[model samples]
Target chain A: MKKFLGAELFFESLYDLGIRTIFGLPGGYVLKIYDVMPSYSKKINHVLTRHEQAATHMADGFSRASGLPGIILCTSGPAATNTITGITTAYSDSVPVLVFTGQVPTPFLGSDAFQEADHIGITRSCTKHNTLVRKTVDLPKAIAEALFISNTGKKGPVLVDMPKDVLISESEYKMPKEVKIKSYSPKVPLKNSEYESFRKVLTASKRPLLIFGKGACSDFNKKLISKFLNKSKLPAMSSIMSLGLIDGTNKFNFGVVGEGGSAVSEDLINKADLIVSVGCDLIKIVPESNLKSKDIVVVNIDKANFNARTKGNMNIHTDSDNFIEKLSAEKGLSFEWEADNLQKLREKYLNSQEKEAKTNKRAGIFKLISNLSPKNSVFCSDFSYEDVILQKFLSVSDFKDSILSGGNGTPGYGFPAAIGATFARPKSKVISISSGINFQFNMQELIVTLEQKIDLTIVVLNEKKNKQKKYSGPDYKSLGESFGVKSHQLSYNDKNFENNFKKFFNHKGTALIEILI
Target chain B: MRHIISILVDNEPGVLARIAGLFTARGFNIESLCVAETEKPSLSRLTLVTSGDEWIIDQIVKRFENMINVIKVEDLSGEDSLERELIIARISTNQKTRSEVLRVADIFRANVVDVGPKSYALELTGNKEKLEAFIEILRPLGLKEISRTGLISLKREKKKITER
Candidate 1:
């Protein structure tokens, strides 16, 4: 054990857990932690953001892109309150994030001291778990427990509220070998009887549809899921969060199937005899009326995701990979779907999309971006009409290739998430697509691109005129220039529009291309 | 249906609020609640009474099990369980009405804990129906005030199994 201050212990604990980066802005209660940040700078990289909300989103984006828990640190009161939206976003999407907020001294707690807030009380419902560190000795254990809780089970945001006095005090700290929380165990072992029942259900159904959600994205065995679907010859659909899990071009895969999804997939939801939803929450996506008549077999470890809102046929209490592996091993399991019918639906969907691209300029812009950007590019969009258009056109081949504020549908999620995604996937191109009003949510973050010299492309579809009567937004060209980044403006009918966009796309550094229609 | 949900949780601050907040947020009502330290000093047992349909009760149970501090949750609704509540009632009695109050207290097997010239404070422990009956019978005897501890329940186990 080593005697170290609470601030040092906090950094050391995170370093031991393989956390190399954090995003946040320091303030009054958190200044002491920042003062000692340089000592650990060689080991841990800290990204200073303009706002606490952006810092939270950056961490969330990092997690969604890399499958690593995003970590954020900030001060108490308003700073802590600011992270709530970002925290709720991660919570709704089942993305793991660790949020550390500095609080007032223990003596001043509940006295309405300056810069003090009840962080735990405010974040209780939103977080997977949250705690306030009252004593210096418990700081290390609290961080370990918070990390364990956030990264395991349903995987959402966890907060650790650190009182200022605790940060100033010193304690003999030892790294915990393992964290054991008796109350939480995400694993539900599959029984042989369960497999038998699942096989029976599969054998009885003729046209079974497979639906994927964010819960299935963590399997990392993307090929296994693909192979199972191909061998079984079952049609499949994806939720907004699981946009890229199944290849969009696959004959059996009918793109996304929710409010932001395609029309063909929604119609298919009504046609299927049975739904084998793997790691997806059907209650949020499918209407209760549609789900009532159909047989649903939900495969998810969390009991909370089961169909409490409607009647469910069966629940396989296990992870997607476990259930998929078992199902793939079954013999003589075949689906009775007509290939001709599926082909007709696929062709009709593609035809409608092509017609949309020809008619709608916004749809055309998305088509252009999808056609021009590298196949491995990561696209992040704010929750807006522009995101819906992007989702319809973008064919994602990689897991989480298309990111959005899916569960919470937060407006200003695109730009900051793009910044975080850039850091997470440095080898791949990262693009942030947003409309005029949505981009203004976190527009101040434009300086981050210039400051970090990040390689990212900002695509703004200028549709502010639609909301001009409500509010007038700033000029994107001037905003980009003031941030010292290359900026370009183009209209849909401009001469050599594609060529201008191509030049900006391959600009070799941070740049903005505002497309006006 | 009324459900007696007994929860075993780590004895820590803010834990009670976390468990209760789930019900409040979901628009579920808690009829009564009792909390005390368990035999294991590190844990606390909270017995809560609530009424809802089967589906709603199942959802509530799953949510309670999901909390980080909750070690275990059991719905004692269908189990062989014993429930009890303690109540203290104070009644004003004059010289003419003292015998009537004493007779009512005797019939309910209540112990007189405090006595004054014009008042008698009686304490009784029983199930919901018994307690309610005793209160109803004492109301006409110049009942002054009443305080009750919420229901606390435990499941029954075979005595031989533990002895072995």
Candidate 2:
């Protein structure tokens, strides 16, 4: 067996796991991983993000878009701290992302060494699984487990914190064929009895409603979902995280249900006789009062948090995709409370909502986005204000195509995720929309786009009144111009603003369009 | 209600601190905590006692299992479990109390660890009720110094313990 630097073995392990890309910023104690990057550069494309936090968003974006584990690397201390929100966001949404952070040497670990951090301590609560490797031989095992645990039963973020000495030390490398944890059994396969129990409720649900949530977005079962929806002919709505589960054009598919949910979606949730929430945590979307209706069924991939989230009549512990697949096979009882009435209500309400959005300057961005978006476009957004527009107006064909911070609700998800989306689908158009303050969260990512020459368009909704005051009175145009991206600023009220907005939207290459409402 | 929850985690460095930090972050205090290596060489069992309402305890237990290092969490509150704490207490000795202290220790089955010039160090391990009873008896003897190992618990093997 040839001797190998632990870092070499670690990167090789990532390559073995089929991670073709890594997003990270280099810092102290993490220099070893960067030093070895050149050796694996051919096999892996490392996108160097400016802030360590954005590295996580980039990885999160990559994972959400590609359905593959996004690998993020950063040094210890502040670098690792930046991963908290991103990792938490991924954890909340159950996105598969593997994070690797450097640590000070073992001797200095507790002595408050320079650039030292208790990465495991900080991220344990936010990650699905995490470990700090003490030995070089364990590096390969740790990396394998990190990826395995991340992409396993309930997909989420995992971290492997490597001490500096462990990376520099020599080790004999042998890639493990399989990684297994005796304690971890992520899958609790559905029993026939359990599935049958849920099936009956779903079938007997007269005036039934279907709710799609984040769990549905992780791995969309397109055939299964559409078949289930069609057979039921139930008026379907999705949580904000699952905006693109069904296209807005689909009759059965109503708009999102959540914080920025439309008035119509709220009405549907309230009036439904039986709510069959598929893979959605009812707490995130349904108002607390409406969570417990006459009948509610919560079907989730992980049933661990369900009992706490709901006093539901039934909880099924099976993969959401599997449950939907099984549901499609069953000849579901016809729920005919009149699909026509709901469809008519949906059309009237959806149209009215759009008309209402068109009347206001701040909310008008939704109408503008809907009008300006061409075919084959995906939008990533951040925070409260912009989330409303992106969740409402952005036309999404697939849930995977729509990216936002659903669970973590962290800001600055837009830009980096757009960068990752560009990489995920190079042929399609990717847009990042956020309010000015939230947009500035990862404004440093401007360098990532410039260096990678990625095709992405960034649109900032500059709320006219800067309530936060931090993002006020700055020329966002100048900031983008400094980064060499085509920067343009226009007011929502400016004459011919619509024409310029469309032109900018249709323009090729990296660009930032700041809209001052 | 006060709940005793035990967590099984990977036996690695800083893991204890991580577990401690989680309590701090959530603004939950660990009333009594005892950690020891389990049967598995790479895993350790941590038993913590804390008091809270049903909802808070439920959330705390859920959060514990969600920790990356945590393998399992068992809230041993209402279960058929055995909880014990070790206490080493020093009693100021006198002609009258010296005999009384040993007589009390004898009844409690506690071992006399050391006999000082003016005090006796007695070691005891028992359930909360038993320990409290013994402490009450020793209170009149005067407590010089006391050290305690916080509660450590295990589910009394249900297969055998309940089968009989």
Candidate 3:
């Protein structure tokens, strides 16, 4: 007898790759894969979601929290297409995710077959890589490649479009112990010349600034960055995406820099002689216009980011952690204190008082995070005003933690991502920062979070309406209405909102806190 | 500003498309790219020359490393490494031109992979420099067509490195 069945082989491969859970919806097209899922239930738990979008979001969450590739499975057509938004979110944010979609049978393909869509083409732009499995025998390698693509350098989502016939085809399966792709290889180390160039720039600079992004918070670079930041006494400002990377309260911390960022933070970033940006894109720094001055030097991990600035700027391409480590070891660097100017700048922008106000949420959800978060806590948030506010609050604390958010400004991302984050960091407390609108967008995520027994605390900011609209005009109310959130729903009429939220979390292992504003 | 990254990957269809899509979608610049199978079977090496800042490169590398079939990725631009060769064939057969091409090849330690009646297939091995020099000499000698084997390199002996 052949040692492995196709579906069995697929699940085993996923297990070997350390994937413990799959988030998705099941249908006829994926019945075979779903049937074998039970056999691996002990090792892998499957989270059944109401919509395919939620599944992908969960995978996104898991990937962000764990620094491991999150997995999602869904049926064909609308289901597969539904994952596009989530996949795009992962792509833009650089999240590692493996998405498996069931396709119509090969015989039925391109015939307007029931629940059929060209997933390969639709997702081509959003995913880093995607494949359409034609044979059952190819399943193992295809799955492996998807996992690999999703987890590798500049990590992003990879989709595997498995036709129903391929899933059901009987064939002997041989899983490759290793997969080798000729066209792809992740650059691991910095070139010596690049390293030397960075050293020369660092050594020659009087005032240096370090800007860390979400990617710096990964398990691979966290400690390395921490060591470099402390040893160099380099004042650092984190991108909003990288809020909790360093302890926000640390002396060297300057907070997040952007449109809504602290005034001091922006000044520091602008005035730095040498700006060492670790995994952060210039989107935040160069809002309406470019901030590249002749004195600025940017060292980044991805070469694609080198001259992203349209203006004339000095940029070096190297892995952020790699460069930081090299710079820390370099000897003979000294700078004369430009104290008076530095003090003037600091006095002009730094607001220790605003920092306290930002952290005032500490008395509410912010405090809960500090008090309840485990050593390995993973924080995931949706695209909401509250999420940004929470991020600003967390910016001032020193919680060596990971934060996951929608890079594309997509709403309803928090809950599913939180669920995924829980799976990614099972030992840590996973928290979701959401608003009433986001909560409504994917309320089903709460069910999946509970079913998976994922230890999660969802802090839902209960407001009667879209707070962002108050400043924008009449269009805000119309937008809220379009989202099915009525004016009445925006207001907190239920006096026991917290108790209701607590009840939702009770006995489910997951908790929900509805804060009335 | 463009740095060439040589990656050893499984010679599977769609791999190139996937890699290209990644660059294009991210709006990263791919100044030049060359992909072909190597001496190894079922494996091809891709030399992608792209330009980006440190953040973009990190993002690219991180994305590449996560792919399943990609065996290894090396940024040859930053390391002290051995140069890989690219073979190009062009129509040029005059004795003087042939000798001139061979002289340039000999200087760069290149080889004649093929010798047709009207075309000489020259193989040059070196970093972009030697290859460009070889091409420049051939250019005056009826360099009708050109193909490059992007870049393949092995790290000079020193320290063993591990991927983060």
Candidate 4:
């Protein structure tokens, strides 16, 4: 008979799943698991984060970069609660993360046991799925299921709450050979009627616009999207989260569309007769209010968004790539009207090329990024006017990777996520386009990047004052003060910040570059 | 249009709540709903009859499909399918109603699975219409209380796979 502790089994399963790192803080309830962590240190790296919130963010960053489910572990009670924000962040962003938390012993559960919190109940809303291990025998299966849930379909975070007693309990555990969740099958093949209807709609429409959302940016479907964009010559704009899905240089590209959208891109979206939203939520930011046009077609993996938003239009529920492929295969489609509009857009928006004009730090930073970015570099940007400025100055080639925060516009997300991206694709150069103030939120994360020897570059826009206040005046400063920023205290001089950053990173075995204008 | 949709979901807590919330948040009307565990312990099947327009139904299906626990969804309105049968027996009989009930049971092909000195039980399996018709007759003949296994379905001939 083979006997093994449940914590060992859980870690073994994680190791088998190719998990290389775990971000977490230790606690009394999870001490046993932490004790066994050293035995597997050679195989897995544990990141001791200052806060559980940061741990979850670290995991999220890892997931965004690697496309693998990010793993996180923490103790019970407040420790577990701290991870809620991170889990919610991952959930909203559709990042795959597996979160593990300790619990008081099952016997002591619901009795106000020390460090006991309703981990499952609290995290249920934030996670795609959650499970509590009641039996020691269920440990392996539960962990496996958590991983499966985190990685499958519209991937998001999943939580497994392990009771301390269950962790210490001995049982003959056999990992489930397969998972058969009958009620939850996510595969939906397009119906024949749906296909015909979509084909007819596509053929009849004179002016068609493609709006790619984050779901279309999956690694599995990039080629299909590229092929479709190449063939259709339809002007397309990605959601902020879907930034790099379509190459900026593509003839049909209209750039990102929203509040921070380019003037030309917004103009094209407003003029589109038939708007095709692929895997986008059709939310307020990408406002339907602006789309008074009735002829909108939404193609999405989620039927609810499509159906809800399909009042005066056609809604197609299918995988983004599959729908694009099906559309590409249809015969007798002429887009003469679309071609005319594309040319008009090109003449209006594409004609302005100002590489020689460097008037401000925003423009300078943008030019620097465009000039120095390697063929396959990944750019992560903070939510600043710099994003808009960079859009104007930098022309992303077909090969570079661009990751944006999208719906979850959390500040300080860029630097850590960039670090995770570097870890995910070590061969690719990873850079963060940071706003000066947003950098203050997760400054501690830079220590992790340095310690891990991750190759990531942080390009901070060193504006001595809040430009929004400087330009928009006292009103903006009032709002900034209300939001907890002391506008008066915001100032910086040219003080060899690059070398200082390099020295800080040098101790941790990483590289840093700071550009001051 | 009110369409009958069958959904397969993981047998976990809060899944039903999430599904219901999704529908309610959209202000869609769910006329009737039935959910229960199937042969598989870890999976549950939900049958919902909803009245909405084409766009609304499409949205409901699309949103439901996006949920991680939802394995599959089927709209049976346009298919050849077999609906499930639920039977309940309420008898008030010492000897007189017993024979009458037995004669009726024999005629309707229902089985008397339970029996007591004053009461007897009969099990019937059929479509909702047939079951309702039988219940109407039983009601007048002193039917007691009834239990029903809502609606379960399988395609009549071949399995039709619908894609998203």
Every prediction: chain A TM-score: 0.96, 0.94, 0.85, 0.86
Candidate number of the best lDDT: 1
Higher-scoring candidate on DockQ, 2 or 4: 2
- What stretches of model 2 exceed 4 Å from their correct place? A218-220, A308-312, A466-472, B160-164
lDDT tens digits, residue span A313-428, model 3: 56666566666667667555555435566455445444652554545542245544444454555666676554554556543232235454546878888777777766766776
Q: Write the per-residue lDDT of candidate 1 for residues A1-517, one digit (tens) a residue.
A: 6689999999999999989889999999888899899999998989989999999999998888888999999999999999999999999988899999999999999998998888999999999889999988899899999999999878899999999999989998876788987767766667789889878888998888989887888545477767776777788887778877887767887877776567687778888889988889877877778777788999887877776666757988886777777776766677778889988888888888788788878778878888888887888888765566566687778876788897788998988999998888888889998888889889889988877778999998876466565325667888899888899888767889988888778868888998876
Q: Check candidate 1 and list the clashing pairs.
A: none
Report the lDDT tens digits of candidate 4 across residue range B1-164.
Answer: 75778888878777888788767777887766789887777878888777777766776676676676777878887778877767878777766667888888888889998988878788999977888888887876779988886666766778853322
Clashes of 2: 0
The local distance difference test score of each candidate is 0.85, 0.80, 0.68, 0.71
Better of 2 and 3 by lDDT: 2
For each candidate, report what fraction of the true interface contacts it reproduces: 0.61, 0.36, 0.36, 0.71
lDDT of 4 by residue, A38-147 (tens): 89899888877767877877788778766788888999999999888778888887889989999999889889888889887777667888888888788888888778
Total backbone collisions, model 1: 0
Docking tier of model 2: it is acceptable
True-vs-predicted CA distance for residue A173, candidate 1, Å: 2.7
The docking category that best describes candidate 3 is incorrect
